[model samples]
Target chain A: MTSRRIESFVGHGALILGALIALYPFVSIVRHALGPAAGSNAAGPFTLENFTRAWVGGGFSHSLVSSAIVAVGVVVVTGAIASLAGYAMAMLDVPWRGAIMGVLLIGLVLPAEARIVPLYDMFEGWGLLNTYWAIILPQIASSFSLSTMWMTTYYSALPKELTESAAVDGANSWKAFTRIVFPLGSSALATLSCLIFLYTWNEFLLALVLLPQNPAVQTAPLSLSFFAGAERNTQPEVIAAAAVLVALPVVIAYAFLQRRFIQGLTEGAVKG
Target chain B: MSLGHRDVAAPEKRRVAGRALRSRPATRRAHRLRTTAWLYLLPGFAFYGAFSLWPLIETFQYSFYKWDGITAAKWVGLKNYIKIFTSEDALSTFAHAFTFILFYAAIPVVVGLVIVGVMTRVRIRLLGLLRTVLFIPQILAMVVVAVAWRWIYAESGPINAALEAIGLDSWTRAWLGDFKTALPAVGLIGTWVMYGLCMVLFIGGSQKIPRDLYEAAKLDGAGPFQEFMAVTLPGLRGEISVALILTVTAALRNFDIVWNTTSGGPGNATLIPSYLIFEGAFVTRQVGYAAAASVVLTTLILLLTGGIQALLRQRK
Candidate 1:
């Protein structure tokens, strides 16, 4: 018993150390954002000046709203498309199921880095560059495969008898889907929405390339990058404050919905 | 005799009526079902084709030409591909990406295994909190991570302060700015972001293993290390493959972290393929060259992931 107690003690000690290492950067960022500049004494004299400075200088007020717009657009677009396709594949008698599945699987593996250059030219040709459409359109496309696959799996797992019974009540295919299949998949939709929100929120490269000269349209992360580089020398506190602001919403959302997020993320991993 | 004749004739008429009524609705329902399915797929396919599939084909076609974003194009053929292979900077960048596989893939898997092995035996509390804390990195924007780490590695940053306090002040410098340590410093950040994922995957995998196997190992006088080798490692093969594919891809296609931190700077010490491709297309006006590099990078990613999947399948 004594030996077992010692072993548990050592294990907890190691775990606590690991947790500290994981959280140290966040702690440092919080401290720097609240305290004086680095060269000052380690103790008191904290201020909220950094948050105000970052809000104005970093242009996060505009960019955060922009990020929100892009994220919401991507989630709504992806959710609607994925659910429809998933229903067709899972619940309906769709021809060429193998071919459609093949295409989506290929899309799943194709990286965004591979296609960003051509996408830029295409958007330029269509007069869509520097617009929210440029970001939202590609984000919806890239995110489609995963969301579709996730919804397909989810709808497939549900009892088919529910939809089948709905069909016998004089409902057309569309009505059956809208009334029965859609409402039953609400939890799955929530999970997919959370995942899409996270991806679109944290996206950087597309936002950087598409909105290069326009801070008005730039997403929060991209704006933060430019803001940090431009103000690194003079405003360490402001940089930390801006970092917190950029990360805060996502962090809060994750805190509330982490169980769903984890389950959704690991769903593909387990199934594959 | 009259009643029997009437019964037979009426039954035949009823059967004919039923067949006529059923056939029309059945065929119509089949046709409607097909149309509905196609309608459901139409919007997804349209967007995917326009944005993803079409541009993917365009990327390949663009690699064969020497067109700038403007003006008429010249046919470059294999010249860009040759440059990607022959250029010193390009060659070193590819090598640097492969080196990252160590920190991003191998180290994370090993660390995850060790942590899981301990947790299996000791049953630590606050597992949920530990997982959430560790996964914080994976959720944050890479740009935020890069900025935060840059501060942490600054000259008067916390790292140096700690070193001075411990009386090892000579060892501290701007970690990301140094030519020697920049790539590894960047790679360590990848390590931190990735190990949590690996650990999460392994924990899930380990839980699926039967408890009896561990009991049998203990009944045979197997120690903790022996039991882990006999039961835990084999149980985790699937998770390890997944962790490898995800982390290796992240390491190779790592642009955001590298871009925000060093921009492949300090004299190209931390240069990787994605950054190179971006610079080639935008900075140098070498559209064909950049497209070719992208093609190669994509092929490399597919090959590595495919190989990992195949390797794991063979062992099974």
Candidate 2:
């Protein structure tokens, strides 16, 4: 009895400790953001002035809007493309299935560093640098690999009778897809959307490299980097506030859709 | 929810469709369906080809030429690749990236195994809540994580303050600024962001293990450690491979964290390949050299992931 009790205590102790370690940084930053603007009294009297400073002085208002636009644009386009291609790959008689999977696998495994330079040159050549297309187009292109893979996996797991019955009822492929398969895959779509939104919102390197010349297209994370860099010495509170602002949307999305987020990440491994 | 009923009815419905399809000209239908399928695939593949595949091929092509993104291209085959292999500074950058695999991949996987080992002994309550909290770091912008940690590691930050309070001021130098500690300090941040993911994957994988195995282990009088080794470790092979592939890739392609925190500073103590490629391409205008570095980095990622997959497959 005592040994069982000790094991229980030890397990709970380790997990709680790990949880606290993970949670501490955000708590500290939030406290710091609410503290006095000039000093670093982490738990000082709470105030909202730092947010206003970071929002207005740091140009976060504009950057956050830019982030929203870019994220939404990439999500909508990638979702459509992924759904169509994934449906064809899993259900329909898509030709060159092996070759297509090969291409996507290359995209999936290859690092972004491998192609960033040529992309830069290509965009620059077309005078597309600093445009929202410069960021959104490439993101959609790169995101296709993961998104299509996700959708294909989800669709392939469904019972074949759903589509077969629709076919017997004289429903064309498009009709069957629109009415049955797509609606049935809502949970999967929701999971994919959550993952894509989080990834797009948090994307940093692409934004930094592609959108530096245009303030209107710069993302919140990139802007926050510049904000924190300039104000690290003099305005730690504002930098903390800026960090909070940059992280807020995804954190909120994560809070409400935590299950979907977790499902998207672990589904592949768990099923295996 | 209807999947149960659909599973039973699937063969009947498939036969009906198969008969109806036989009434039509099969080859014509096959050709038409193939064409339609290609239509569905075209948009996605077109974008991927233009922005991803073509650029990737272009990177390889540009790697063989000496051009500043403006001047007439001079073909210098193998020279750029030779420099990466021969240059001390360039070689160290690759080494630093590989070093991150220890902190980012190996540490996280070990921590995850330890947690799983502990977990097998007792049931954890509020697991969903714990998972959400632990997984937050993975989703947050790396810039935000870096900003928050930068303060914690600052001279006047919590670590320094704690050291001063404990009369250990000598041990309180800037964590990110010191040459010897910079790489490890940065690498440890990767650990903090990564281990949670490993834990979650392992936990998810563990639940799929059959209860009979645990009962059998208990019947055989196995200790907790022995039970974990005999059952839990083997059950989590696939999850471990996924975790290793994800974390190792994150480590090797590490840029945003190093960018926001240190910018490969303090005499290039934290410089990695991605950072070097960025600097060479844009900042220093060594375009061809940067392309070669990127190709090397990409090759390394593919080789390592392929190696991990093969290793795990053999074990299975």
Task: Give the count of colliding residue pairs in each prediction.
Answer: 0, 0
Q: List each candidate's DockQ score.
A: 0.50, 0.56
lDDT for each residue of candidate 1 in B215-255, tens digit (9 for 90 to 100): 99999999989988999998888888888888998999889
Error in Å for residue A13 of model 2: 0.9
User: What is candidate 1's lDDT per residue for A1-272, written digit by digit as tens?
Assistant: 67667777876776677677778887788778987765655455887778887899789999999999999999999999999999888877688888889888767777787788899998898998999989999999998888888889998888756765666666777887788889999999998898889989999888888888888889999999999888878888889999999999999999999987776666654433
Q: Write the per-residue lDDT of candidate 2 for residues A65-112, one digit (tens) a residue.
A: 999999999999999999999998888877778888878888787777
* Interface root-mean-square deviation, each candidate: 9.0, 4.0
> What's model 2's lDDT at B206?
85
- Chain A TM per candidate, in order of listing: 0.93, 0.94
Candidate 1 DockQ vs. native:
0.50
In model 2, state the lDDT of residue B282: 88
Q: Can you tell me which runs of candidate 2 are displaced by over 4 Å?
A: A39-44, A268-272, B1-24, B314-316
